[model samples]
Target: MPRLIYDYTKSELERVSLSPDRFRRKLKKAVSNLLPYEMELLQKWLVFYTDNRPELRQCISELQSDHKGVC
Candidate 1:
């Protein structure tokens, strides 16, 4: 199953020793500071999904590998 948004966000913050609420507040402020066009681009990318599910899975796996190396 896909992870819930709250669970994913909470785990990510915990991995970096960040307070989830504080991080969210900061993110909200940062997003609010974006220009309208920038925000529109962000929304587009945020909602983009692959038509090929297998390719999406592979992309996510590759990202997870990269994340493991960095973190």
Candidate 2:
């Protein structure tokens, strides 16, 4: 069965909250796993999630232009 977005989002958030490296890794994994609509929702959530995290914001900004994959 496919994973539920809520569970995936929650688990990944907890897993990557500590560092930018982990956050980037998990974001890539999420991008690969989720459908386009799911990814869009995830991106929105990511903006709120990363809003206060300068390291994560920097990491995201450094992603390739094609994969600017998050908000």
Best candidate, TM-score: 2
Q: Model 1 Cα displacement at 54 (Å)?
A: 18
Q: What local distance difference test score does each model get?
A: 0.39, 0.70
* Per-residue lDDT over 1-71 for candidate 2, one digit per residue giving the tens place of the 0 to 100 score: 34497467657766778988887777667767777777777667667877998888776566535486443
Model 2, position 37: C-alpha lDDT score: 73
Lowest-sum lDDT 10-residue window in model 1: 42-51
For candidate 1, the TM-score is: 0.30
TM-score of each: 0.30, 0.75
> TM-score of predicted model 2?
0.75
After best superposition, candidate 2 residue 49: deviation in angstroms? 0.7
